[model samples]
Target: MNILKFQHEEDFAATGANLIASLLQSNPRAVLGLATGSSPIGVYAKLVEMHRKGMVSFARASSFNLDEYVGLPADHPQSYRSFMNEHLFSHIDIDPARTYIPSGNAADLDAECRAYDKLLEEQGPADLQILGIGSNGHIGFNEPDASLSSGTHVVDLLEETLEANARFFDRLEDVPRQAVTMGIGGILKAKQIVLLVRGEEKAEAVKQALQGPITTQCPASLLQSHPNVVVLLDEGAAKWLK
Candidate 1:
């Protein structure tokens, strides 16, 4: 794992956007793995700015998002699908057909998970994957103690995850208790992985991820074994690392 510390979130976002732009420049049809949450919001903003300046074009690029709430509609205010569309997709020229977000309303939830896994196999081992560390060190809703699913599947949200995410919803109860997420196998298969963390709240999680034992307890710690992982942290988030 390669760790890059930035003084501010804006700089962190800039570095991430430049890295993505570089990948897109090298391969127009690159498959991108995306994440949602406040940590990545700045990165998406930077990408949109790059798009407007012709610094990068996602016109031919394909993307797969990491997770979504299991029962929420795509248009739900708190849904990851809605988050991505509002934050990044709407600002870029990427073909909607080339973008894939797991369906939250599958009639058979298990079948939906199976289909997402298949879709990932067909389009992935993502060229680049963007990730955010949960306050509890969970990644893609793979809560602590999870053995780590090998494919897309439904998972119950841990209380920490629910609380962290509740800020996005009007009421805490509005936050869904279950979600569908691409599993660790999918995340580890990315050719390049960029994990972003910011703010003081993430300091302990970042420290634990960087220095803690490689147990399921700190799921993000698994990135230590990836061949091409880049961890970007703002000062506040990196404060506890030393």
Candidate 2:
């Protein structure tokens, strides 16, 4: 893993955006695996700025998001689909047809998960995948566990994840307890990965992910095994790292 420490979140985001832009320039049809949450909001903002300046073009790029709450409709204000549209897609010139976010409201969830995995298998291995670490060190919704799933599937959100995500909902209870996310194997399949962390709240998670044992108890720790993974962190998030 390559680690880059930034003085501020904006710097981290810009650096990460430049990396993505470079990939898109080299491969216009690059498959981008995206993540949503406060950690990546700045990165998306920078990408939108690049698009406006014509520094990058996502017209031919294909995208797939990391996860979504199982009960939220795509258009729901708190849904990851809506979050992606408002933060990234709406500001760019990317073709809507080339973007994909897993359906959170699928009636047949098992089939939906399988189909999503198949779709990724067909377009992947992803040229780049953006990720965020949960407070408990999860990547996507792959919460701490003895074993992690290996494809897109349902997950019961951990209490730590719910507490961290509650800022987006009206009440703590409004935070969905479950979600659908790409598994460890799916993320490991990506050709390159960028894990973004910001804020002091993420300091401990970042520290453990970088220096602790590779264990399912801290899902993000699994990235230690990936051949190409970049960890971008702001000073606040890197404070605990020795």
Candidate 3:
């Protein structure tokens, strides 16, 4: 684990974008494992700026998103696919056909999960995976539990996750109770993991993930076992670590 802490938001976003830009520069066809949420917004914005300036390009890159809210239409404003398009995809030159995000509203959700797992198995093991930590210590939607799933699957949203995401919806009830997420096994297959964490609310979770014991109850702790992980933390998120 390589932990990098930043006191300034600009510095943190810049460093995160630089890492992706460097990866693309070396491997134009790099496979990216992407995540959605507040933690990565700044980094995505920075990447957009770099793309506009010709500092980086995603013309040949392919991407796989980590998760999506179950029961939501792909065109829904809050859907992960929509989120990616609005934030990162639309701004870059990456081909939409090559970008993969699990279908959350498929009639046969079980089959959707299986298909996603199969697709990942055939075309994945992303070169770089960008991740964000849930306050309850989840990575993707793999909530803390006695044991974690090894492939793509559906999950019930925890109260903490629901509350944290409620701000995005008009009411908490509007938030979906389930999600489809790439499991720990798929995430771990990435050649490298880039963990982006911000805000004081994530302080303890970040601490537990990086310094605490390896346990499924704190899902992010699993990253501790990965061969390569780059943890990027803003001051607030690193409050406890300091």
Candidate 4:
């Protein structure tokens, strides 16, 4: 694992965007595992800027998002699908058909989960996976527990998770109680992982995730087991890191 602390948000964003751009340069068809939330917004913005400048092209690239809220339509303003479309996909040259986000509204969510795992087996081992740590240290909605799933699955959202996400919704009640997420195992399968963290609020979680012992109770700590991982942190988030 490589931890990089940045004095400025722009530096953090540029370094992350450059990592992905370099991957695309080497492998035009690279598979990307994406995440949604505040942490990754700056990185996505930097990527979009690079795309606009013709420094990177995503025409042949494929992508899979890490999770999506259950019961929300793909078109819902707060949906992960909508988030990706608004932040990265719309501005890049990637083909819409090549991007995948688990269908949160599927009638048979269990089947949908299985299909997602199958798709990952067929098209992935993502060249790069982006991640954001929850204040409680969850990743991709994989909340703290005695054990974690090994493939795509549905999970009950933790209250902390819901409250954190409620800021995006009109009311707390509007926040989805369940979500479909790529499990820890699925996330580990990525060839490389990039973790984006920011804000003073996340400092403790970042400290626990990277410096504390590896445990399912702090899901992001499991990234310590991965062979290749890069953590980009703004000063606020890196405050506790030694």
Candidate 5:
């Protein structure tokens, strides 16, 4: 758990992007575990800029996103697929066939989860995985619970999680009540993990995830047990860290 604090957003973005760029530079075919949400927008933007400058290449690289809203079409404006296309995939040289986001609209959802986990087990175990902590300390959609899943699965969205994501939709009710997310065990399979957090709104979560007891109640706290995790924080997010 290597923690870094930054006063400027640009510095925070660069640091996160640097970690990804460096990974791709060294391993052209690197498997990237990506995430969505405001925390990663700047990092994705920086990666796109670096791609344009010829500083990095995703041509041989592949990526897997953490989750997607259940019941949303892949082309939906608010879908994670659409979000990734607009922010990162569209600007990079990566092969579209090589990128993956768990299918949220599959008719057989449990099967979809199993197949997605199978894919990761057979081909992934990504070299670098990026994450964003929920204000409640949840990672992906693995909300606080007595136990956690070990594979990709569907999760019921909590009220706070739904409210936090409601800003992306026209109405709170428009936000999906469920999501397809990689479980904690799946995420922990990555060779490296990068947790990016910003805003004072997340300060308490940051403190709990990094310092509080490792419990299922706070999924991000489990990262403390992983061998390689780099946490990048802006002042606001680190305000409560001791």
Candidate 6:
């Protein structure tokens, strides 16, 4: 694990974008494992700026998002798909056909999860996987638990997760109660992992995830076992690193 701390959020976002830009430059067809959350929004914005400046291009790259809300339509305002489109995809030259996000409203969600895992088997071992740490140390929608899944699957959103995400919805009740996410095993398969964390609120989670014990109770702690993991943090989030 390599930890990089920045005093400002802008620097953190720029560093994260630079990493992705370097990957795309080296491999035009790089498979990106993307995450959707506030932590990554600034990074995505920086990428968009780079694309506009011709400093990087995603035309040949493919992307796979980490998770999606189970009961939301792809077109829904708060859906991960929409979030990606509005934040990154639409601003770049990437082909929409190559981008994949689990079908949150698929008639048979179990089948959808299976298909996603199969697709990963065929086109994965992602060149770079982006992640954000939840307040409870969860990654994707893989909340802390006694055990974790090895492939893509559905998950019941925890109260903390629901409350954290409620800010995006009109009402707390509007947040989805469930979601579909790539399992920790699936996430670990990536060739590289980039964890982006910000805010003073996430300080403790970052400390536990990076310097604490490896356990299923804190899903992010499992990244300690990954061979190639880079953690980018702002001053607030990296406060406990020392």
- For model 1, the stretches where C-alpha displacement exceeds 4 angstroms are none
lDDT of 1 at 165: 84
Taking the tens digit of each residue's C-alpha lDDT, what string does model 6 give over 134-214?
999999999999999999999998999999999999999999999999999899999999999998889999999999999
RMSD of each: 0.9, 0.9, 0.7, 0.6, 0.5, 0.7
lDDT of 2 by residue, 4-119 (tens): 99996678889999999999999999999999988889999999999999999999999988899998899899999899999999999888887887887999888889989999
Better of 1 and 6 by TM-score: 6
Clashing pairs in 4: none
Candidate 4 ranges with C-alpha deviation above 4 Å: none
Q: Is candidate 1 or candidate 5 better by lDDT?
A: 5
- Each candidate: what lDDT? 0.90, 0.91, 0.96, 0.96, 0.96, 0.95
Q: Model 3, stretches more than 4 Å misplaced? A: none
lDDT tens digits, residue span 1-242, model 3: 99999999999999999999999999999999999999999999999999999999899989999999999999999999999999999998999999999999999999999999888888878999999999999999999999999999999999999999999999999999999999999999999999999999999999999999999999999999999999999999999984
State the weakest 10-residue window (summed lDDT) of model 3.
116-125
What are the models' TM-scores?
0.98, 0.98, 0.99, 0.99, 0.99, 0.99
For model 1, what is the alpha-carbon lDDT of residue 214? 84
Q: Residue 91 deviation, candidate 4, in Å?
A: 0.8
lDDT of 2 at 210: 84
Model 5 lDDT tens row, 185-225 = 99999999999999999999999999999999999999999
Q: Is candidate 2 or candidate 3 better by TM-score?
A: 3
Task: Write down the lDDT that model 3 would get.
Answer: 0.96
Per residue, candidate 1 scores C-alpha lDDT tens digits across 69-168 of 9888898877888899999999999998888998887789899889888888998889999999998988987888848786888999998888888888
Where's the lowest-lDDT run of ten residues in candidate 6?
233-242
